[model samples]
Target: MKKKQLSIIENLIWNSAGSFTYLICQWLLTWIIVVHSKDLGNAGNLALAISITNIFFNLACFNIRPYLVSDLKQCYRSEQYSAFRLFTCLASLILCLIYTCMFGYTMDQIICVMLYMVFKLGEAWVDLLHGFEQRKMRMDIGGISLFIRGILSVLSFMAGVRFSGSVNTGIIFMTVCTWSFIFLYDMPQARKFEKIAPVFTKETIKKMLIEFLPLTIGGVLSSLGPSLPRQFLEAEQGSKVLGIYSTVATPAVFVQVAATYVFNPVLTEFASLYQRGEKRRFLKLLFKISFFLLAVSGASLVGGAVLGQWGLTFLYGKRIGAHADLFLPVIIFTCLNAMSWFLWSILIIFRELKALLVINVIGVIMCILIMFPLISKYGMQGVNDTLILYTCVLLVLMAVLVGRDIKCKFDR
Candidate 1:
């Protein structure tokens, strides 16, 4: 029992450390890029290329990631991981190639996209690692992977950029190095629980593919919210606009990184527990934590945005700082949107696919609309307002659905 208590403390500390490292590294990298590349167009293009490549990565990996976490754990535990992994790799590689094809770009963009794939293939494995680790009842392996990325990112930033080529090269190279480490070490550690099954059958792949269908669509639509819109804004608005948005939006990443730290492991654990018939305890515990964290993070979003406004004004001159007001609402709405996301996580756990569909569908519709109209009229600030409205609606919807779910679950 004492051991259990200590383990929990260690997990929380490592998790917090991991998130803090991510924020520091991100802030430092952004500052360097901003200082060196005042050409908003080039910086925006870089940001856009990164966005494009990541979106492609997310598209290819999609639901399969979480699918592996829940599904592959069965393979690992049953000692069937050899066949399971073979089929998983074939499927992932095929999808990666397919996603690569979908990226239409100049040679430079293509090169960046390919490099991103190599790095992503490694980094994205974190999803699978988290699943396997938590199934063994230890979340630290995944936490360490995150800490490693944070450390490398900081190291790369501290090394500083003597040239544009160097910074650009460092970005992908450092990521590749870190992710390779994760892919190498973490997979074997996770495989300790892996059960090598005899048959890697056609039916298994078909089943995995079928299960991924809804999630795939939902994911593509979801990725568009952050990734695609930014690119669109960069194209229509400009890189300076992208940089400013990124700067203002930086604090939200802190909230997200921290939220993800706790949320990802819990989501995996909850999915596993639900499968094992601990549904009642699972929902009760989830509801409490979900509500508390959502609220805390939601408040933090507001505080962060307010500070972001001041931070921007000071960092950039008044001319640039005037744009800070445009960003504050985006931060607020993004936080609220994040709260609804916690609720969605519960919905996903219960395989409430239909509800999940409705939620993402509605949120996407609002976001899409916000993209066209406000972007035309008010530029960044308009996008910020519409996002706030979008998240507000999302939270309202979440409250209604959660209230309904709670009442129905206990109606008897």
Candidate 2:
């Protein structure tokens, strides 16, 4: 039986629902640690695990999903992408272990980091599968998989933590549950579209690695932009402080996630518009998306101002609520990050890989230059400030590059 293809609106709804549920579940893990365990340090440990693994997650993913979906010409086979992803995933896992050891983390932290990396590995693999479904315009299947995985993993984690009283145990449960979903649900759904046998040929693998290397490096640097601050905070102030910062910064992620949900469904459309020389319509769509991002940012700021502290208190406890000042800056940083991501998508559609790499490199350089001084002087607030600066610079540089590309190609 052939499955029906979804309209863009249906895709958006399903994707949004699935992503929102997954993100909310992820957020709740931190909340569960704080409220159930009554330990900010546990939350911090989890946060640190997440911070470290995210860099490697980017490495493994190599920002390929967007490239895959937007490959209008079908330049690469699904099997080749799968094979390449398998290689990256193994490399990321090994490198994660090396990175964790080099940082001289305690055994417990190392264990936690490894467990979380395994969990994130599951996500990375499933993300490739989602790309397959998305390329077929069946994001609904991907969304359903995400929704189910989210529910199951969170429940399993909560139960494990509740019963065992250890975050690592919960993560183990989460990891197991996630991979189960991948084997049972996601793989099946993706196989409906095509056979996902991994194909490894030297020529194809080398070509893919060479072509996507810039995006891979940019992804690592971009991940570092936000992560360096958390890493610094953990080194200087310890896990409790990082926990508070991670908790306070959690809500702001919705801005970026929401922005992604808005733009991702229309990415193919944007490509189509540009490829067809529909310049006016492309610009109009771009402006609409920008306006929507701005509106969402404003709403987030207002909400942060009005209910940020109280809400943090209500959710995670007063320890986190006390850092309400971080809320506004975090929201701004997230908004900027979201805008930068939108610009990145635009540049990707334009196939301006060098510009994308250069912009992210500059942002990362800015992060390294200012991260220490900011952290040394301002404490956690400095972390927020550093990220804001890095993302702000990225947003500006990318905007300029995107503008130049548009002028050259669209404006005539």
Candidate 3:
């Protein structure tokens, strides 16, 4: 295919694959918790623990995952196949061990962490596969992987019709299967890296590791930023309210998930444009999309939520909608926040990665200051208010950073 044709296909694949994966993970987790636990308190506890595990897995992958994607893209173009695989395997093993004993971990936490880390290793290969797909712009196969995961997750739910262990086990099995396929998908493309393979050395690996820091720290802190408020709420208002809060958070979470899928390929393209020194296109796309992102994603959510707040019913079910009123501010901000991703997306593309690390730190700190006190007094609403406040702070900071980035170009 020609270059433009290839671009379209790749975007198609990347977006579709991401949507499939997000839906699978969302429904699977949602049902597993609902069916397994009886009360909101127990369900919220389980959700909280599982969420920490998910974050821990993300941290576990942080060491080299992003670097692997970035470097693997370069290696594929440069024909350094063997070296790429060697680095991938090395990075995977290192991550597996780091998660094993790294944190101030408990014995049980350690076991679950290990199970989760294994999941990350599998996921790392998936990233490598995505890197390959993006290199060739062959998104179809990547979409295939997501479809497979989604199918397995749905089957898991259906199997719960007859068997009790169906939910978690099916989810695990789906995770294992998805990663295994991704690893297989990556191996064939490793051939493209053959020529540059021998030049790969310790120095090269170290450089990649260093480059990984900005995104890794940002991803971790960014992951924790929204989460910490809920932790405060749990500590103060307790788990029942937290569960209700999380349930009502569905729309925001789902939209964010969809945004992520669309954002990934655009991010890769953005990074490439930056590398190619295409400043004008980057800024234009950044502004246009950022405006639309906020308008479309924020509007329906804020409005639907206001009505739902005053009313007593849920479009999905009353159970999950009970605490919808308490999270209105959160519902609105989360929409705005989802759109706000446009800033970080550009940051990723611009390679102003340290911006991510620094800003998310400020965001987390701000969340602590704003939410912790309010959480004890007002419950989930307090948590919601804190999120809104931090978002405003971050929004202004992002605007300043983006404006500076633009001005720097003119100065040059």
Candidate 4:
């Protein structure tokens, strides 16, 4: 069998397209719901729900996909990785359910949140398959699955909400779309690389979990750091303002997704370089990537400043567009946050899990302490300001830690 291969440009296109498609669909779906229902509050609630669910999903993921993808030693079989992902997905669902129930939401909110969980779970399963695809250099499969899933899920969501006038119904349709794609597309493609079966050795699972614990904790905190603003807005100003804030801030996600997709295909090469003592080449490539991310951030901020309001109105609706001015600063920090994420990836490449944990913990704590006060004083704009401050501090800390680690490891 010929091994699948793609150049950097090809990898960038497929991965970025797929990710962009999903995010656009999600953003569009939120817009559609908000517009059609004439209920900004519901939109905000959904945003908060999805945001919290994403935190859980990231926690469940524990940054394992990349850890699995970068397994140059082939220490574990595909089945074992798959089993861990499945276990985490189940655990995430269980924990999310418990948290939701304990908070005591209305019946509608509970149903909507649970359905979103189902949708996210299915997406998580596909992401595990993507790790296999990425390892095999078959990112085309990952691209195709994400693109198709995004299209179908959003379309189903639109149809459900448009016809039935219910967000819960729309979410259910989205879940169905995920399951259909997972079984029909992702699972079969994954099997072509290796068999798909659960492997549960107690000791092996425990060891893998322990090894990945720091990264996992870091992933959760990293997600929570940004989520603090949305959670606060939802609590303090109510869902309508949150909805507007969410929509205005949503487009910035593209910058982060693009950076990740662009960098992903080269991760294996970084690991190989490190393994072969090509420290100079590794560090050179790392700096180049970081510089590219900075360029991307700069471009995004300029673009947002120019087209922020218009773009928001075009994608969402006029109601949401009123807050579009917030896009500029929000996107600036988003780019910074994206760069910080890239730096964390460097730490992961070096397996510096403790540093990753420390960086993210401090970031989250800073965000929390300042978030409430800012949101209270400045309203929606304050949330954006708080994020910018948090990301700046976080980015500096990560850059310093990662740079020191590289020097210690490769300075000769």
Local accuracy by lDDT, each model: 0.60, 0.89, 0.59, 0.82
Stronger candidate by TM-score (1 vs 4): 4
TM-score of each: 0.80, 0.98, 0.78, 0.96
- After superposition, the stretches of candidate 2 with alpha carbons farther than 4 Å from their true spots are none
Can you write out model 4's per-residue Cα lDDT over 203-275, one digit (the tens) per residue? 8889888998889988988888888788778778787888888878777888877888777878877878877
lDDT per residue (tens digit) for residues 1-412 in model 2: 8778788889999999999888888888887888887668898999999999999999999888878888888899889989999999999999999999998888999999999999999999999999888877788887888788889888999999988999999999999988987999889888889778899999998998999999889988899889988999999999999988898998889888988998988888788888888999999999999999999999988998999889888887777788889999999999899998899888888888877888888888889999999999999999988998888899889888888999898756
Which candidate leads the pack in lDDT?
2
The candidate maximizing TM-score is 2
Q: For candidate 3, write residues 215-307 as lDDT tens digits.
A: 767776766767778766765666676667776665456555565566555555656656666778877766666665666566656666667
Q: Cα deviation in Å at residue 28, candidate 2? A: 0.6
User: Which run of 10 residues does model 3 get worst, by summed lDDT?
Assistant: 63-72
lDDT of 1 at 123: 51
Clashes of each: 9, 0, 4, 0
As for TM-score, the candidate ahead, 1 or 2, is: 2
TM-score of 4: 0.96
